[model samples]
Target: MQAQSLSYYEILHLPPPPHTTPTISEIRKAYHSALLEHHPDKSILTANDSSTPTVDEIVEAYNILSTSSLKVLYDQQLESVQQSKKIEEARFKRLIAQADSIDLDDFQTATSCVQHSKDIFAESSSITLSTGYARESCHGYPEDTCNLQQIWFRNCRCGKDDAYLVTESMLEHAFLESDNAQSDDRQILVQCSRCSTWIRVLFSLAE
Candidate 1:
């Protein structure tokens, strides 16, 4: 299905405001205005059309955009859309790994390969690698259970097996690494001194 096209600010018809935040009163006012304009009952009566969206739509939109937790979810949805094009392009490039048609077993293997590549490249000063994977598990028992995984990597060593998991913190670290490695041949391997599950880094020299 095509995703919804409403952002928090757009839902409330407000300008793209700063993260400094708005007060509850301001939120409520914006919500009420949106409700008045879009409530299906009013629209149907005035426009004599059954295709108008219902009051529930307005309520749901307001609930999502006005509350802190819901607002965060809405913001994430927006971000997902904004990043979707880049994600699709990356996925297309990895078509051979059938990275687009990966299974659970392949996913785990791909993740390990990608992580390994990132670790190796992260030791250099001129290049860097970042990897990420995301997967969702099925809801059934042992036999029926399964997971769908999506992997992504960037600026790291590109190899047949190098596909990694994606995470919010990883993205932030990658950005920081990119910034720090701009002028130096310095390599930084940001790995867990313990489990070593999460790794992000920049490098200047060969692995």
Candidate 2:
């Protein structure tokens, strides 16, 4: 099975920590049960089948949990991982909610086809044009001012480096589409060139 994706507690069928920490006895019992159920010699399943984890995986899980120090460290790491996942989920939900709230009629009338926002989206600040660290590629920028204008790039969560791009003309187009009198607070939605994920590129058009 894809036991690598699962935590040690999950591998042993024991309760994960913080919410419900399994005792040493419970870990031991689960470990033995897994060995009995999945041991290569004891298992009747075909070699090609990946229904159960290998004997090595079970032993690795058991070794970590059986040790008090390692279990504590693993619990902390697991909690951090779970917290990050929750945060990402919340951000994704907010993005979805914002998308649902948009008036399709108004969006259709906008000059730029890309989505615009009056408020900043999550992670918007993380990939700022002011950073100057990201690669600058002017290839697809406005043809007339291509030399002076270049697209800024940021790494995407999909592991693609410099996948998210924001161009000077794109920001200008997004700003022109805004109906708001205040020009200091505006953002444009930019999708990763390599992935389907979208990120907001915050900027000000005010001179």
Candidate 3:
């Protein structure tokens, strides 16, 4: 099961603090509402042994928000979390701008291709271009489907080290623009044979 990401306020369906502070009574009300819906005894999810958070979680969230010391600490933590998100968003925008400046067709020369990938992908590792046939492996990036890593590299700058650059998406965009992708989202993943880091490669002219 996917990990939980919802904040305490979000789990309770109340406005985050500093915007609208939920009173102790409101917190209690929200807790009961969510508890009845997600409580283990009433929840069908318990039958399947699912990973959904339990009623204990609802009580915990309510206690944190309803208490003075705990609520202040949680609010501070939320502020830190929001600030991190904003930083990530700004970094993403910069990477998008960088990816836009790259020339995908630089594959004409090995050095040019290496330079392009480095500039656009922004990884410090050196490039080791793949010369052999495609390796038989997959990264399973898009949910369940295993996308074959197209370009096989022996010693190269491995996959994306920075979270800001959406290398997989950029590679797909570049690949579709450079070659015929046949309307398949499955073809978007690429990988490093040496480091085993997931990367993206273009489709071949042969198929």
Estimated TM-score for each candidate: 0.33, 0.48, 0.55
For model 3, the run of ten residues with the poorest summed lDDT: 131-140
In what order do the candidates fall by lDDT, top score first?
Answer: 2, 3, 1
Q: In lDDT terms, how accurate is model 2?
A: 0.62
Clashes per model (N, Cα, C within 3 A)? 15, 0, 2
Tens digits of lDDT, candidate 1, 47-163: 443344345655676676667887777677776876897897776455433322222222222232332333334544333222222121111224233232323343212342333
**Cα lDDT over the full model 1:** 0.46
The segments of candidate 1 whose C-alpha lies over 4 angstroms from its true place after superposition are: 1-4, 16-21, 44-53, 86-207
User: Which candidate, 1 or 2, would have the higher lDDT against the true structure?
Assistant: 2
Models ranked on TM-score: 3, 2, 1
Cα RMSD for predicted model 2: 13.8
* Winner by TM-score: 3
